[model samples]
Target: MSLFKKTLIKKNYKYKLLDDGISKEDISKAKNVLNSKQITMASQTRKFEETFAKKMGVKHALMVNSGSSANLLAIFAAGNPLRKNKLKKGDEVIIPVLCWSTSLWPLVQFGLKPVFIDIDPNTLNVNEDDLIKKINSRTKCIFLVNVHGNSCDLFKIRKIAKKKKIILIEDNCESLGSKLKNKHLGTFGDFGTFSFFYSHQITSGEGGMIVCNNDNDYEILFALRSHGWLGGTRFYPRRLKSYNYYAKKYPSLDPRYIFVNSGFNLRPTDIQAAIGLNQFKRLNKLILNRKQNRKLIIETLKKDRRWENQFQFIEPSKNINPSWMGLPIIIAKKYKKQKMKFLSYLDAKGIETRPIISGAFTNQPATKLYNLNPTKRKFNSAQSVQELGFLIGLHQNKISKDNLNLIKDSFLNIEKI
Candidate 1:
């Protein structure tokens, strides 16, 4: 089959990976922003940022174009020359193997060395012991990923970071509504990022938010989100100093266009922010629905006649209250080779599926092009996930009986494979 022909003939599944991500209410909110004709980062965006910061218990939040941009901004801000304790070139940064490409790319883009750490397969997060062993005096930062709404012991990881004086940046994009113990997963580090993508806990079509507690970091993020322009929160007298001081010093230069630091234009539109804010109001409800749907699917599968422990499901990590993005299932070792065949059968039967976060990042072709893992070091745990794991969506709405039956039937097709 020709590539174009194949694309045209791709399976049309009855159950989609994500249902109508934007609701009527969400559209109404977005329409209001559109009708106002004030779409570019305005009052709506600022309001969303304030509400997000309050809910996440962070001092400040900056909305961005996408989760990838959020990651880029966080790492760039960390390495920016304007920061007092910024990372320099060739500094080592530790990250998990089971992470998204954007999580690792920013470190490489900034000339920082990335040290790969394996994940604990059970928790689907970084292996703390291995992470600790990889840390040395050269390590300047820890860009940890909270995988699939689960996290490693973030409290212990925070303590380790504190002891080592390393900057902690949590890629909490997949785990936004998740909590570790009583504290939220994203709030455990110097910088934490969240995604409001189509399949996340909340959806805004395409958007992301970065949060920080320190006033200086917040100011840096705000400026960086724009074109490095100086004035963001001029309401505060203290914040006006950068503009005032520079205006006085330069005399001729316009304070409005002062490019104080290196930056990127990663701002989210007001329409996206409006939709995200409306969805944010239903976040708790969405989280609960997904959790219940996951339980129902697991129970329904177990009750079926085909139930023979053909798959293993990932459980929430200790001291964590998860907000699942999907139902991650690992095929039995005996069925690993036939995984693709089973997945195809599921698709043919009108059930949709996806790989677990693009499997292990090191195994990707882009990693080789960038020479990310130069030593070709093996990540056994991560590799196992690549070989054995696949996921099906757990919707934010309760699973209907028809959909539940379809899921059970499709999953049980593994027996034939």
Candidate 2:
């Protein structure tokens, strides 16, 4: 290739999406924190927490080290002895099969049975019909996956959870900045979690937050976050009574050091908080750019002469204004078995791709080893999604004409491959 072609390819190649859209302002905030040297989880963390809670419209937000930890906290907090109506061992939690491993594992790690739910082919989220049918007396909660920044009719899901008295946990890891009917995705559930991992809606390198509406739940989560300590509120009379009767006797020992509940050390650094807050300020811009890039890619391919119903774009469901993180392409049935060749071709062409959130997770080797698939639940849509669906980055920067053409040409090569 000539030097000109090399430069063009370098400029036109679809790069990995920016997980952290850090403007000059975000870096300045981090530099200020670094210069101050109060660098663990302090002032910036608190500010980020307040701003996040207010933005998400939740009563409280607890920043954690990672989204996976946020999930673990949410699951374990539900089962905490301090919680009045806690999820007991053997109770069932409904989760979509087309989900990330962490979302499903947390329920099982907490000793709650995970009832697998299939996703809608069109939406790539939990099917409402399947969800309603699966709700039984033993059902204690439903852990929903707002897949790749898109969600189902969360209002309907919330109504069902309320009617059944089941806990609603929104695994909003991929769907940050997304809104359903004008409400944020995470705020509808009893507990909603967000991730700041690289390539997600926003990145802090590795960080997460959990949101809830109840004061008691907030207190439990705060205690659960760091060695179960009630440092901030132990001076209160009520918490003292619940602790050892000797809390008063140990007054000189700093009532602030009071241990109140089960806990873990899942706190983000001040630096991550600074960066995350900066990205949060510009979240709308990131969401809009990614959405536009996604449209351009789709339009480029669909307009090509080689376009022949080769793939289907997973459409957002009703009332879902998506903040897409990546573009998921579902190959048509005739080309389903040719998935490997097509993806391999794309990969060879330097177009990065990945499976759609580890697809039909029940089909995983570990699940089979545990004999979790014997009941033979029909997950045809999830199965099809597994076989056909693959994703590529929807970058923050605008897709140029040449890059868009490259994507279109590569995608249309489905015929030749």
Candidate 3:
């Protein structure tokens, strides 16, 4: 066994937000790419994009350096000059308050306005009724964050977006491999984004992908992912239908280097692609392991003699087959004030924890800095979640008895803390 594996085993009782998600095979694949020495966004990235598209039932997938980049690309592509229906400055985008910063930043960065809505703390997703009610003529888009592996009824949202001709972007970064009615969570919107960041469903250290069905959208994204070059990298050529037309239009310029759109250099390296693809192939196993581990942790805690409904766990939404990112727990209202103390206790016990997606993003100081909420509209449910909820690692492996005992003993000490 490797020294790393031996050390990890020796410290198995100490819990973290993530275990070593990268495996030996994943490392070997990356090493092979390094040996090739052509480690830019090349063949491996293209292969991973193709495989991800096919398996996720999408028409196209473009890889980027990170999930934040994926979201940025999706937003910019939606508003690109090449598209017929493009978003413009001041257009409203409805998003849940319980979202990561990137999910909101992309919209703001693209000169669009974000309309924050409340989330259903039970499901840890947007309140579908609230979202539907907020959609007005000024609302041009809906950016949904499938938080921590749970999603709202995407079918209903899709139907509404179609009727309104509004763009939809799904941030499935935290919920990859999850499904609603047998369809993947990220496949329901006009543009879906996924992350392969550490502790996500799969990891490549830092990588992400964006998907779309329209050929035009894909072309726009393809160009935007690079420096808006018509011809992609030498190893992976983008033969857009407009290539010939652009070549003829710009006779003086090199056809292979035609600049066609506003863009960013968000391409993922071949090393990231290699490692991400290796982990992608085993995504189902990883999802299953997380599911089982979550079950074991919760069951172990609930069956203990100290169990007294001191905490509540979020469950999968209706018709949703979740791919859990972590084990999210909400302290009972009676013990709400003790949440931080309990978390510190867990930390001292060698168990790591984090808030549930930055605890109602509007409360973040950055949001105040940007004056995102001038009206001071309160999201009571979201605030409740922020006060009561926190999460711990749900590893991509079975839970050991020692670890389970540690979690149970530490978590049940909420009252004492």
Each candidate structure's count of clashing pairs = 0, 0, 0
Measured against the true structure, the TM-scores of the candidates, in listed sequence, are 0.95, 0.90, 0.96
| Candidates' C-alpha lDDT | 0.85, 0.82, 0.90
Q: What order do you get sorting by lDDT, best first?
A: 3, 1, 2
Residue-level lDDT tens digits of model 3 in 1-417: 231233343444389878878899999999999999988988899899999999999999999999999999999998988899889999999999999999999998999999999999899999777789999999999999999999999999999999999999999999999999999999999999999998899999999999999999999999999899888776774488899999999999989889898878998999999999999999999999999999999899899999999989999999999999998899899988777777777777888778898878889999998899999899998899999999999898787788899999988888888
Q: What global local distance difference test value does model 2 have?
A: 0.82
Consecutive 10-residue window with the lowest summed lDDT within model 3? 1-10
TM-score of 2: 0.90
Error of 3 at 134 (Å): 1.0
Off by over 4 Å in 1: 1-12, 232-241
Q: How far is candidate 2 from the true structure (C-alpha RMSD, Å)?
A: 4.9
